[model samples]
Target: MENERAVEPAGIRERLSGNEAVAIAIKQIHPDVFPAFPITPSTEIPQYFSSYVANGEVQTEFVPVESEHSAMSAAVGAQSAGARTMTATSSCGLALMWEELYIAASNRLPITLALVNRALSGPININCDHSDSMGARDAGWIQIYSENNQEAYDNFIQAVRIGEHKDVQLPVMVCQDGFITSHAVENIKLIEDSLVKDFVGEYTPENYLLNAKRPMSTGAYDVTSYYMEHKRQQAQAMKNAKRVALEVAKDFEKISGRSYGLFEEYKLDDADYAIVIINSAAGTAKDAIDKMRAEGKKVGLLKIRLFRPFPAEEIREALKNVKVLAVMDRCEGFNAYGGPLGAEVKGALYSLDNGPKVVNYIYGLGGRDVRVENVEEVFNELEKIDNSGELGEEYRYLSVRD
Candidate 1:
């Protein structure tokens, strides 16, 4: 409590939208470069930052790029030259940067990405969904999802420290739901500028491409002989990221008074039925959980904040006591069995002697409303499975029109 008071001291309180909060964060951090192209739901991030540049509020070198691909390419180049770099995108914009995403990760650049989660195009969506970031799950970036504007701001600030950790030099994506948290105004507490600056510290790459004395090489083509070995190293770094992220979180908690873990467990201790979900939907589920708890339902929720480098062992331990569980996905897995969260959770518990009977529910794609009633229905489904000790169809859709 003393630490929190010392770190925050009732610091700047503001009613700012998620985009504006992120913009303010970037201005405070004042990275060396911000190369970006605009896209909906995410466009305001760069747009707001550009204003900071115009007003000389921050000395960040703003690079207006031609496309999202070019934006990412410029970031890679800037970071390779040993400059702190950041950018923002959503949906198709993130899709456009797909190729470069792997390159940035493989090269081990500590570029912080402000990603607004949005559904990918087909029928064309400009709304919140996990499809964009979920599609890039295996691309080897540290992914953090925020539930609200406060979390969005906090995550972006913490991302810098996480990505630049000495043991884990990897890119980090700070994601928030489009239009939901992104545009919605919320009350947020901000750490003073000097505190954030001191926390993020300096970006001193061990051996950058421009280190004349060290003479290091980046993005060198590797044949089969060394390719697998390099991938192994990247994998190890990702595993290291989990611990590093937690360490950073602990440090952050001292300042913000808001604690975080890999996932947040709500009323899971004595829960017989539970749902594991991500982002804004978790908020809705919590409301449903509360109402159900009032009626003695023993329903609970696991809200995942960190998605990539999936914390299998920890998650298994968290949900082990629950008799039945539903792993909800905002995007379709399209695998015919379960969504990504379900598949990963199932894989994590495969070796457990007694694990919850888990099912998958695809919901809230393309900005579809996931009300408290919808969440209640899922808990009811879990209750049915818990009582019967039998599983029905494994994968289902919620709130979808037939």
Candidate 2:
């Protein structure tokens, strides 16, 4: 659906890293408050944004919080007070904000979290992985992933609109691969500040704790009588977000010329075998898919863009006709099955009468690389499964020194 009411176009093409892109998006939005704490890979986000604050590029009140928990707490309080708010964090930093993450969502505060995906500590490694955001999968935020710097910028911009939508007032997590996209510089087209400001519009909330005209209670403790209903409302709002996300994406495309959806289907129309994955690894899988396609093999790729509220219907429709499907997960779910993504895909396809044989592979933990050859090897496994007509081990590790 094209937004036929065209506004004046404003954008500039420039090279920026993922962190830079997100900071620039925030600058363009000129949010009311930003509670910032420093963490690896993601620290650059606030580091750059702080400069903008110091230079008076934007009016955002930059709160230099001591920890990620405080950062999110500040965001929640500011947002509750009817201020547009945002923050950035990664890895253990995100883990620290776990409790507040639930608070921000449950209270229906439309705060935007820029999460640069990284490995969570146990063996303590600092690099790119999905362990951070994936760990908070059930925390009630609308999660979106980006495959490159440009998508990171675009997702952050759209997140503000999606989370702030009247029907879907939920927090949004815009995730990008840590070092892969966050630290790596790339050419990106940026929409004009006026265009972005017009696109995002003003954050005139309907009801807030600080709205002097009308007083209302928020985040009040609910006993058993109303707790379940509150939970139900939160769940319903999440369901509402799937539709709002697509609508915002469509509107975003009208101005940016960069289209987005629940997921990106690459060469999947006639594919006999396909892999469902997310984030930067999708690029590697796409390259592998091209090679397999050139060899006359019917292989394809489905890159998940909107993860939370899972997009199950779209995924089920996209993969229903394939002969075999492989779901690639970058973080381990440790459910004795596979990663969270693989498990979600299986659930998505479980009701289909003649569902394709689905397999799960957990790969790239602690920043392990998934090269094109590794993706080809996974495709080879898929082809073998399709040909054999007998499902082999359903859960396996890909390129992990196993």
Candidate 3:
């Protein structure tokens, strides 16, 4: 949708790295409490603010934690005390904080975190993959992705604004591509501090029945019968987040003069085939789609911005007109399915009355290079399987050499 509203403020500068932009956005909100244990790509952000704390550029508690687990615990405690909290980590650091992440969300705390995407170590090395994100997919926090430096900065602001919105007091994780986008310098436009402050306003924790003398407990112990209800409450809040995300995204575009939505479409309007993907990989697919269009191939691309709340209906609707859909997964999920995102893409479109035939392509595992040509290879395979009898269990590895 066109952001046909007020002009964005002028201080929105023209150049910064994705991490730097994220830092600036956090400063805009002036979080009441920001805490962290440094982890790469993401670690630099907390380091940037250390001097700010010492010189009082930002009035916030910069906690020194021995581990990422403790960092999240500190963030949760601060959040419960009605303070806006922020922290960031990647890979193992993210895994360490897994438990508290869920607790913060189930208790409806607006703790916004930045996940500078990095490959989780197993064979023991630091790199990039969606493994960490897919593992935490069910952690009850909203996961939003930024494909570039600007979106990283923009979404960081929106995450705080949306997470703290009264109707949607849910924890949000903003994922930015580790070194590719996070550390890469981009010509980013920074919205002014005053404008961002006005746009985000202030954090106001809702006064639930547990306030003051009421003495109600949060995450209170519950038997089987009541436990289901609490889960239902969480489900409903997730639903609320979908609507709020769209509303907030539209407003953000108006305020920053940049546009984004649940997804971005490139030549998908009337294409015969398309690929549905996420994160920085989508940028690769977009380039391939452009090349295909030039060669007269009817292929397009759909980049997912909001993965949680799945937006299944929206995804189906977006790909309805296409004849075949190819899903590219960047992270493997072992025996569960061919890859994590491929599994989700299948689930999202399987039930449609007459959806397009879909194919899953596993690519870029362990940070293996996946260029635009790799995406085209998958698109070619998808075209070959367009009218095949097979449907489910239809995933493949695009660039694997025998």
Candidate 4:
């Protein structure tokens, strides 16, 4: 007991996988209920929790579910009963729970899930990609992507705070590349569990409509009169979630000494051109940007972390000095105009003044590589736009077969 107080809640270093990082981060909040299923890369998170429960480190109900659907069902039931709950899944596992994923959001349940990003089957490989996440893009959860192990750990810690915030009662999905991040090991300086316990504090379900004492109805059949307004209320909560995320991140920074907000801006202050990308590709682009700058070229990178409630204001500010931007996406929008990330960038820039010219580059499909060299090609394409003073009529493919 004296050791608990002597711990001092300080930062400690350890090598952790994306899955293990999430497990450690969630342990801080001490979830009361977990109904988890095993899915590739996602399996280790719950496995860690199982060990925690067995070791008597966390006094919580750990439910080892047989299937994804049942796992989600347990989460909904637990959250409805006013318990702090969580779960994890991937690809088809996520699809199996799709029906409940929406319900968790619409019911305003503050549950959190870690998605070890995976590639959906058809032509399958147990590797890394964003297909699983992009497929569930509109599932109504507050979706955020992480580039590396540090981000995976950091975002998972912040997710509970943001999702359970009084103004933003919504489910959250923290996404990281399947095998790329989920399986890789990296050095992470973790805050003491005691500090995180104090930082995240506790979960208190507010405005819960389900109660035996109050005799209130929960998830009742809504008629046209109330259905639209109820959905509007959900939308408002989602918007409020963005601001609450910033506040949670701000408070988390005070305790952990690591900072992150809407998106990560890299060397954009005086650049004439920029690249807007997400996930692990941003790490690739960062390398390219650094190389180009060393060659006396003006370039920067903007990495989008939060995709669900897109950060329009910060998006505009990050590119304020740039004259051109290349928005690269891993997944395609098929015949649509642009992929998810590209479309969001354009949506954010419509209101900006003197903004840079933006082009969409779709590449790295089906677990392909987005090596650092590919970003140089994107910058070359942006230069073509700069010199010719004409935006390309079609999307550019970076290092992909014709």
**Candidate models: Cα lDDT each:** 0.92, 0.93, 0.82, 0.84
Residue pairs in clash, model 3: 12-190, 13-190, 119-127, 119-128
How does candidate 4 fare on TM-score? Answer: 0.93
What tens digits encode model 3's per-residue C-alpha lDDT throughout 214-267? 555566677898878877888888888888998898888777777778889889
Model 1: per-residue Cα lDDT at residue 248: 95
What is the lDDT for 369 in model 3? 80
Residue range 195-238, candidate 2, lDDT tens digits: 89999999999998888899988778889999899889999999
Worst 10 residues of 3 by lDDT: 207-216
Off by over 4 Å in 3: 1-11, 208-216, 387-393
**Candidate 2 or 3, higher lDDT?**
2
- Structural RMSD, model 2: 2.4
- lDDT winner between 1 and 4, please give it: 1
- Badly placed stretches (over 4 Å) of model 4 are 1-10, 207-211
Off by over 4 Å in 1: 1-8
Best by lDDT: 2
Look at candidate 4 and give me any clashing residue pairs.
none
Q: Evaluate residue 342 in candidate 4 and report its C-alpha lDDT on the 0 to 100 scale.
A: 82
